[model samples]
Target: MADYEERVKLVKEQLRLAIYFAREFMDVLGKEKALEIIEKAWIKYGADNWKGRLQGVPPEDILKVMGEWFKAQEKVRSELKVVEATPERLSIEFTRCPQYDVCQEMGVPEICQKYCDSDYGAATLINPKLKMIRDKELAYGADLCNHCWVMEE
Candidate 1:
């Protein structure tokens, strides 16, 4: 298994490659079409990535489980803070995101939003009632990324 630094390097490399391919597609297919395809692909990627992980979790416990997952990742990949956590909602603030950093360094910060948008699909896949809301993002120049997960009424 790769160590933390190695894993981080790998993730950054993946982001760089994704940007490269996205730019290539933009050149060949046009910007709008390329972005549309990229968004759809990421949404499906998000859903498929979480396909079976949350299938067995009860609706009431979904937020709790998600909160724990975020907490566990606080120092591993990003600087995170659990702002609020309850049975119905989980809110977290990411002060640092490697994805955003890599994207910005590559001069294509907008790509980070594509990655961020994946959370919505991932949430819905995990549980139909789950919704992900993120108003602030580091990639868009916000100081932090705020992610809130809530159960639908």
Candidate 2:
């Protein structure tokens, strides 16, 4: 298990990435729109659905899909930033991530949108990582399922 300090450092890094993406994502879709879509993704598909889909597919699929989807949105958003008269709305596939559900539950996604709580200790980080437990709720947090594949960077 990593010490608390290390965990804090990593979380800081992840949050930084989250903020960067959140801004870029919001630049395309306003903050309100982006938050709405991300919340929807967290609701529709999560660890419950994750289990069934992953049964047949290799674990690597998660990382591959997540990374690719993020890249795709990044490209589109970057282009819009460079060009003028852009739509002023981002069409990023918030649901396209192979693991947005997973990220949301874990509270590590680019946005602060709450999720279905299915994404707890589900990640298999090399070191033990802190979880995002609700202050007054314990509805959906579950220990990291060992079965899940590593998430894409």
Candidate 3:
């Protein structure tokens, strides 16, 4: 438990630095261009990582594997809550968010727009049929974040 907590803390700290970097880019390049750069980077990076992980897995098994992967990463488990998990979909509500927290701390919570939007690029790389819909986010001044990952037939 202690080790897991430590890992979570480490992950949170790294996320802080990542958002800080995004904020720096925002300062230099402006929001629009910085977001474009970040999104492109995430597309390649997310594709590489997901392709490697999902390799050899059948399309039918992709959602299961992806769900398990998401759960494992959410293991430190502070901000996100699983609302549902099925072969067709995985739904989650983010009640607390390290990214939002860090951005708030830095007084640039909107920086999260660049970071969160990358998820769409990464999800597409996972599977063309896999779609992610997010309705709200704390960074946008919402009460919480709602995310749904659905595997379309």
Best by lDDT: 1
Candidate 2: Cα lDDT at 31: 74
Instruction: Please identify which of the two predictions, 1 or 2, would achieve the higher lDDT against the true structure.
Output: 1
In order, candidate lDDTs are 0.79, 0.40, 0.76
In candidate 1, list every pair of residues with a backbone clash: none
- Candidate 2 structure quality by residue, lDDT tens digits, 74-112: 564321111111112112222122233434545555454
| Top-TM-score candidate index | 1
Tens digit per residue, CA lDDT, model 1, 19-88: 9998899889998798778877888888776655567777788788777777777656547788898888
Model 2, backbone clash pairs (residues 3+ apart or across chains), number: 5
Q: Clashing residue pairs in candidate 2, if any? A: 28-89, 28-90, 29-90, 121-144, 122-144
Per-residue C-alpha lDDT of model 3 across residues 38-82, encoded as one tens digit per residue: 778757876788889889999888878877877876676666577
Worst lDDT 10-window in candidate 1: 1-10
lDDT of 2 at 24: 68
